[model samples]
Target: MTRKLLLVLLFLMAVEMNAQKGESNFSLGFNYGFGSEFSNRNYMFTNQFYKVQLYYRLKETKHFQYQILVQPEINFAEHQLLNFYFVKPDTPNYQQKRDEFTRLKDIREYVLNCGFLVRKPIGKTCSFYVLGSIGPMITDTETERMSKGFAFADVLAVGFAASYDKFKFDIRPSVRHVSNAGLGSSNAGYNTKNIEFGISCQL
Candidate 1:
């Protein structure tokens, strides 16, 4: 199901590319993030993701530009349950479950993000932007906080970009949240703070 959804998005992007008269760009990015201490579970989480982004400018003015973004990424993560007491003493097989959930675990996630961007030019070669996106994700491992399989990832970010000739460099700091939106039994999502670096070219 995720593969089919990705294919459909790609097809739609291709069609939109051919139809649109505005500027477009393609970018590659690397992100590193660590979990924030806001959840009920006592766990430590960190992640790294490689991203591919497509941006299509919808409107441009002297001061601001609006664009649509489609991003697909491969994510690698590490999680460790810090406090065994989080499992509770009364649960069945509590000791075994605590041992299982406390061990350091590696996780993988595939994500597709669709979003919008608003940019304000600061100089001839520099701009600042705000972006918001939400998308479907697939997790390859289950842990105490969230179940394996389908979920949703949402992001909000602000960034700076510098342009030189045909190339652009970007640095963005973002907040991310992932959950199944109650589709699964476990819904204690992960929240993280992230920083990303990217380079792109007009296409």
Candidate 2:
């Protein structure tokens, strides 16, 4: 009887010690979404592709913390109907060549962003918040020089997330919209949007 009683006491003490250790919170997540860009007052007849994003956050209080993100995208374009005007060169085929050059077959857009996110945990470790960022963007097409270049793209973003936590494991699904204003001169202006669902583990 004494041996059994001692075993129960040891189990209870171990449980109590573990409970007093508190929760160590670290979260990593990923997101992928369908997105497009808005430019020239019209939806460019380009099929926006999916972007892969990664997120990391650390809890400071119960409501606020620090967050960072990395996003990379691949784009496939649809045929566009556009008119091209050119200065008549000292040759006969200047306008003809310009017309052919203006029509593109394929294009790709790449962007890298780094910024901060703010959160308000509603009840538990799950929260909703807005994200804003700034970074550089590069656009390239398989056709001409006027169609491919790198520019500084500013990232202004806002999104919401739902998170589930099981001790050191977490799963989060989120949606966000990112806008590109302009670069120095090569303005590939568009609103890139995405929706992502991902799972992560905290060590």
Candidate 3:
């Protein structure tokens, strides 16, 4: 996990340098998001995320602007299995499986997202943007549907941003998915819908 994080940071630094060479605008943002599982997995799961974002504008037109973004985030989650549908009657230690699955567990995830944003201005102080990102993630707990260790986090969001001079405020609603891409034994993963609030300052 450390190695992966280091590589991602290096990649972001390279992009930042290139953006600087192009005399692009730079911004720093902080965001908070909360959501719950949307998948029909016979389980209850909810998560909260804290993220820091680095943005670099790549191009601009009279009506639209494009930017590249790098975000590092942490997710805190609570999960509990609500049913035994996957456990068969003939399974060994059925009672034990039920006991374990029914208990609530705390999970944590670390993610680094690199993606692009397209923004369209609605007025001088407000705009709307659509974002899509995918990144590597590390899960710190195991669950019935997802395994601990390496996975991928994908996000899609649409947001409104209002600016006051150098400061901007954002409200975004997003969908998130986490899966191992069949690299692990458990791959059912998680799907969630989230709403995020953010504040940023241009540099």
Candidate 4:
């Protein structure tokens, strides 16, 4: 947890440093998403999360801009039992395995994301954007049967943005995918589909 806290502090500090240089292209943002999780069996599990984002972008043209985002998220709720990996009932160890793995329902996650954003202005202060990101993530709760404690993650999102003076806000719908990327033999990976509503202020 200490490393995570340090990362958060460093992220904020970078933004602060940039602001002191008279850069007005930085924005601080917060996002919340509601979505369903789907597993290998084609099931949807209930989950929700909150994200805090820091964004920096440069206007490349009258209608185009480039953006970068550093975001951290805290996930809440838990997956339903129907999505768990379970041993066959016929196996002698089935009951024991089930009991052991069931506790993961209270799992919480820490995710750090960095992304590149592409924007096209609709008109003046309103714009449309698409983004792609890669990052690292860890979960506090999971079956130890899995080898690794962390995995690589990906994010893809599309959103609409509106700028009003020095304040801006947007709504983004996105998908997040996490995979161990061969670090573990069991890389089932996880996916979440959700929408994020965000508000930000220019520095």
Candidate 4 lDDT score at position 35: 72
TM-score on alpha carbons, each prediction? 0.84, 0.58, 0.86, 0.79
Those runs of model 3 whose alpha carbons end farther than 4 Å from true positions after fitting are: 1-24, 39-41, 88-95
Rank by TM-score, descending?
3, 1, 4, 2
Q: Which residue pairs clash in candidate 4?
A: none
Of 2 and 4, the candidate ahead on TM-score is 4
| Candidate 4 local lDDT, 36-69, one digit each (tens) | 6754552335567888777877557876789888
Worst lDDT 10-window in candidate 2:
167-176
Error of 2 at 197 (Å): 4.2
Best by TM-score: 3
Per-prediction backbone clash count: 0, 3, 0, 0
Q: Rate the local accuracy (lDDT) of all candidates.
A: 0.82, 0.48, 0.88, 0.72
Candidate 2 all-Cα RMSD = 13.1
Looking at model 1, residue 17 earns an lDDT score of: 62
Candidate with the larger lDDT of 1 and 3:
3
Superposed by TM-score, candidate 3 places the C-alpha of residue 6 at a distance from the truth, in angstroms, of 8.0
lDDT of 3: 0.88
Lowest lDDT sum, 10 consecutive residues, model 3, at 15-24
lDDT of 4 at 171: 93
lDDT for residue 64 in candidate 4, whole number 0-100: 79
Query: Model 1 off-target regions past 4 Å?
Result: 1-41, 90-92
